[model samples]
Target: MHSEEDAASACAHATALIAAGRLAEAREVAETALETDGPEPTLLLVVARAHMAEDEDDHDDDAERVFRRALDLFPDHVDLLAGYAELCLRSDALDRPGRHARGPVLLERLRELAPDSPQLLRATASTSVLATAVAKGPSAALVQSLDLLQALTTAASPEAAEKDARRRAALAPYDRRLAVLDATLTALARPGRAPLRLLVRRRPEYLFLAQLTVAVLLLARHVLGPFPLWVTCAVVVLLQLPLLALRLLLRGARARGGARASGASAAGPAPAEPPLPAVRPYTRRQLVLIGAGAALAFSAFVTTTVLTHLEDIAYPRYEAAAPYTFRGMTRTDTGDELDTTAASDPSGRVAAAFTYFYTGGSGDGSELAVTASTGDFHDATAAMVYESDTLLSSTPGVGSLDDSWRADAGAYGGWMQCSRYVEYITGEHKAICFWADKGSMGSVSFKASDMSHADVEGLARTTRQTVLLPASSDS
Candidate 1:
């Protein structure tokens, strides 16, 4: 049986062997120690490392299991926790969706044990950056990443710090994380960078403040008249100054608390004293509520603005001076005009009234109908066509003689038909065409009993070109 000293030495030797890339020898030494001592922490760590070194698919799982067993024996052992946390980091175990997984639990415990430990800081920072990128956005992730890198550099030894710098520089061109790190380092190297770095590191909540400020500014712009660039810049500065002062006050309080704790610890425990009242600057729940409220308000304001703009586009006022004439229809008729602007409709529907009509000598006619308010004629024309289809479906005497087809009409396009019959008005079958151009909706219905489908389509196309195209060109 091996002595305690022999087992300790064996564990050290096995660790050295594993570090030297001697996996087989490390495994043998670790297995022999485990058989003799029945699973000490150091021996288990060595065995876990040996398992991790093996070139196999399940090596990570095997090493994690071994580390877990060691952790059960020595829960507070920093080295075992560190090793397990590192394994978790490599495996992305914290990113998995679940409640308090082994990886996150161990990392939190390690943070409590050694808050200023560089390795732990680095792991937490990396994981936080990744998590923030997924949850928030790229800008937030970049800010958090820079903060962590700063913390890492402050906590790490000179050699390790230099190594990290070099590694980041090497990876900057290929990886976005390293690129952000490099940019932040460059910014820090310049004059007057300390204050900026301090703000980023201590006041990450400023990112949310900035977003809210922008949202408010957009809401203002929509409500009031447009402001100049310099005015907007001044507004942002004015808004942020108060928040900056508050952050500074919180930071000062934290510093003073740390100093008091250090002094109390140095003087040893005092006699039983009264507990101090809790003073929290901000809680996680409060921040979440604030963010959610701000986001919802911003979304509502933006959506309302967009819908208002679309409504204005969909129901624009009709312009009377605009030309609404077409070929094979020359005689202007004004008797059938219907104006309903004076009458109130309870349904609140905007009334469409026939504005003008042109009749041909051969009993062919085209009519121009327009709503009282001007709107996007594209949508107005589409709505009118849809209404016509509904009428055809619901009206007993109205029926289509052939399938409708699309035809290009000047700068825009519309639908045309060879034959559409109204049995109640039965004298001659007619072709029906509807088109939108130059911000106006119009329709042409002509005797089509002797007209071919191609002839109907051609007539509709030519009418749109002659009437609407010339109006748009003149405008």
Candidate 2:
């Protein structure tokens, strides 16, 4: 071994010797070749593995020393770095947390050098703790991590979680719960899954997400407008679509982001890469209980939402008192003279006008006007009359459409929006607000010289509460 090529040739021979089970001879040949030739990472790799392969009680210590020495001389060598990292992780001998600590530091270095390297997967796969691998981001690509985890879970018993985790007395980053969440649970759950459970539990992620979805759906049932049974049921199932789609999009983005973290492709013909690493997951029975509990919880949640919102399946137009007082104002009928404007709505739902003026709200001569123009609003009333905000704002009776903003009608199920602007030539400063809940929808207008937005919204809430009562007692 007189030249670099000779050293390379020698590294190959030593590797063959180690593979042939001649550990002592492999060490000797590699060390001798290093003296004859120059320093070589591959040769040192051979020597280190020979020590690692030896049937001694402390083979790790010897192999680790060789790797450390090689890395010191050739700190940037890919194979040396990968080999050393694997050794440290293998013995659970991570670097102490420090400025240049080895545990996380070694892992970071490998990530920088070959982020997408198959060798990284191989080196880190043997690590007993899945938590360490999964912290922030998995050490390998998501696809590789999934593959490694699958391998681990395959070996794990469907019932023995503690058996595989092999918990230690001291707290470490790598712990049992990480893989046990699904590994063993997947096994136990797989055998008994009916079609629905199969669909629900096919991906552990789906099972968890379904629970999350149920929670959100329950919240929506009360807040959304009345729907017939069909619409309500459709809403219950369709709600999961957006949540699942969001998660899947996020997962794919994470995979793409990690895969592109580094751009250090090799310049020449790429060297032979390591094969994908095998994984061994620990399985436990706790997840089975968790899944069962989750399934039950989800079912109960869905049933509860549908039943509680049974009131939501129908929206009978609310009955209104003929006369009422709000704040400092009192309501008076505007008489039998037809409100031609209300009758002009395209859908005819806004044809029956419940128009009134609540006067005496102020000594400054300000009055609050409310109009419940009713019609076929529950179905499709053109955006112009009962169903439209923009169209309503543009209507002749809604003051001038100068400036407008949306306001909430609180408990009356606010589709109530506020508009603070009015006509081209009128000196009157009016703020108008409107609300919609199925067939029950109306507007309130404030005709005060200096009425603030809050005043308008406040009066609108009072008006909606007074007029939008549930169906009259008799019917």
The lDDT values for all models are 0.53, 0.57
Per-residue CA lDDT of model 1 for 238-323, tens digit only, reads: 76775665445434433443233322211211212212111123347646756765785578568647855764455323433424
Question: Which residue ranges in model 1 land beyond 4 Å of their true spot?
Answer: 2-29, 48-355, 363-374, 377-391, 394-404, 414-424, 436-442, 465-475
The alpha-carbon deviation from the true structure for residue 449 of candidate 1, after best TM-score superposition, in angstroms, is 2.8
Clash numbers, per candidate: 6, 15
Candidate 1, residue 112: lDDT:
91
Q: Whole-model lDDT for model 1 versus the true structure?
A: 0.53
Error of 1 at 7 (Å): 5.1
lDDT per residue for candidate 2 within 317-337, as digits (tens), equals: 566554567666776655662
- Residue 322 in candidate 1, Cα distance off native in Å: 7.3
| Per-candidate TM-score against the hidden true structure | 0.40, 0.34
Best prediction by TM-score:
1
Ten residues in sequence with the least summed lDDT for candidate 2: 168-177
